[model samples]
Target: MEGMTDAPESQKRALRAELRERRRIRTASEREREGTALTQHLIDLTSDLGARSIAAYLSLPEEPGTRDFVEWACENGIRVLIPVSRADGLLDWAPYDGSDEDEDLLGMPTPTSELLGPIAINSVDLIVVPAASVDRTGMRLGWGRGYFDKTLGSMENCPPVYAVIFDDELVDSVPSERHDQRVDGVVTPSGIVAF
Candidate 1:
C-alpha cells in the first residue's frame, strides 16, 4: 500500500514538471483560444446538469476561460457563487448575479450581487474551480496559496468540485502536497474529464 502511494506521488511530480515547461511555451493567442473553448464547455456542462445553484471561482492569470458560465447560470435562474478570499487563507462564498460591473478582489474580477452572505458548502449543488493545471485523477495545482485546501477541508458534505483548465494543462498527474485538495471532475476546452 505504501508503494502504491509513492508511485502516484512520483508520477505526479514528473507530470507537474512537464506541464510547467509546456506552459512556459504557451503564447497569448493560444491562451485566448483555449479560454474560449473552455468557457463554452463549462456552459454546456452546467446546462446539462440542470444545476440550480453553483459555487465557482474567479479566474486568475494562468487559468483559461471567462465567467460566461456565471452569466449563463444567472440567465437560466441558477444561483451562482464565487469565493471571496480572507486574509487567513480560507474562502468565503458570495452569490453571483449577472451584472456588468464587477469588484476587483486580489486582482480577479468578482461579480457584484446582492446575494452576499455566508454560504454553507453543502447548500451549493455544484462548484466550478480554477486551476493552473489538473491531472487525470482530478488533483489540481493552484497558485499555491492553500486557500482552497483550507476552505474545502471545512466541508462535511460539499458539492461536486470541478477544476477548469486549458486542454493542454490537463495531464495524467500533478504534484500534490498533503494539503492539496483533489477535485471531483475536470472541465477543459475539449470536454468534461472525470477521474
Candidate 2:
C-alpha cells in the first residue's frame, strides 16, 4: 500500500519536470498555432452555456491566445471578471470590458482603463484558468504559484474550474500536491474535456 501511494506522487513529479522542459523548448509559432485552436475550442464550449458571470485570466505575452476568449465573453453578454493582485498574494477581481488597452499588472498584461467592478469568486458562474500544463483528470500545473489555488480554496459553491492550455500541453497526467486545486474541465485547442 505504501509503494502504491508513492507511485502516483513519483509519477506526478516526473511528469511536472518533463512538462517544464517541454515548455522551455516551445516556440512562438507553436504557441500561436495552439492558441488559435484553443480559442476556437473555448468559443464552442461557452457559446450556448447561458453563463451570466465569468472569471477569466488576462493572458500574458507567452500565453497570447486569451484575448479571443475575452472578446467573445464580452460580446456574449457574460460579465467578465479578471484578477487584480493585492498585497497579500491574494487576488481581487474586477470586471473586464474589452475596450481598454493593455497595461502591466503584477507582471501580467491587464486592461489599462478602469472598466471593472469588484466581485467575489463565488459569484462567478464559470472560471477559466491559465495552466502551464493539464491532464485528463483536470489537474493543472500553474506557474509555480499558488495564487489560484488559495483563491479557489476560499470560495464556497465555486463554479466549475477549467484549465486553459495548448493542445500539445495537455498530457495524460501531471504533478499535483495536496494544496493543488483540481479543475472540473480542460479547454484545449481540440475541445473542452469534462472530468
Candidate 3:
C-alpha cells in the first residue's frame, strides 16, 4: 500500500521531463509569437475579470512569456505582485511597480520592492502562474516544485488562479497526488481555457 503513494509522483517526474524537453526545443521565433498571443489573452482575462490587482510570475526563457503582460499591467496602473521564495517553502510577494528586478531565493526574477507577507496574495483579484503542463481538468504539473502547490493549497479565499502554457501543454490528463492542486483555468497561446 505504501508503494502506491509513490506512483503518482514518479509518473509526474517522468511527464515533467518530457514536457521540459518539448519546451526547451521550441525555436525563439515560435516562442516570441506565442508570447505575443499569450500577452493578449492575459490582457483580455484581466479585463473580463475587472481585476485591478494581479499576482503573476516572471517567466523563464523556455516558458510561455509573461513579461509583456506584466509590463502592460504596470503601465496601465494595475497593481502587480511577483513572488519571492522563502527558505521555509512559503512565497513572499513584492509589488512590481515598474521597479528594478532582483532574484528570489530560488533565483527566479522578482521585483526589487519591499517584501510582503504570504497573505498578500489574498488581495489579488487574479493570479497567473507558470506550469509545465495543465490537464483538461486544470491539474497543473510544475517542474517538480512544490512551491506553487503549497501556496494554492494554503489559500483560504483564493481568487481565480490560472496557469500559463502553450497550447500543446494542455493535456487530457496529468498525474496527480493528494497534495497536487488545480488551477481555475489556463491561458494558452490559443486562448483562455476555463475548467
Q: Judged by TM-score, which candidate is best?
A: 3
In candidate 1, the residue pairs with backbone N, CA or C atoms under 3 Å apart (3 or more residues apart, or in different chains) clash, namely none
* Candidate 2 clashes between residue pairs 3 or more apart in a chain or in different chains: none
Backbone clashes in model 3, listed as residue pairs: none
Off by over 4 Å in 2: 1-28, 101-105, 112-119
lDDT of 1 by residue, 41-88 (tens): 888777777778888866655556656667777888987777776566
lDDT of 3 by residue, 1-195 (tens): 978998988998898898889998999999999999999999999999999999999888988999999999999999999999999989999999776998987889999999999999999999999898999999999877798999999999999999999999999999998888999999999999999
- Deviation in angstroms for 22 in model 1? 5.9
**Cα error of candidate 2 at position 120, Å:** 2.1
Ten contiguous residues minimizing lDDT sum, candidate 2 = 110-119
The 10-residue segment of model 3 with minimum total lDDT is 97-106
lDDT of 2 by residue, 4-86 (tens): 76875677667667766776677988887888888887776666465688889878666637788888888878888887766
Q: After superposition, how far is residue 190 of candidate 1 from its true place, in Å?
A: 1.0
RMSD each, Å: 4.3, 3.9, 0.9
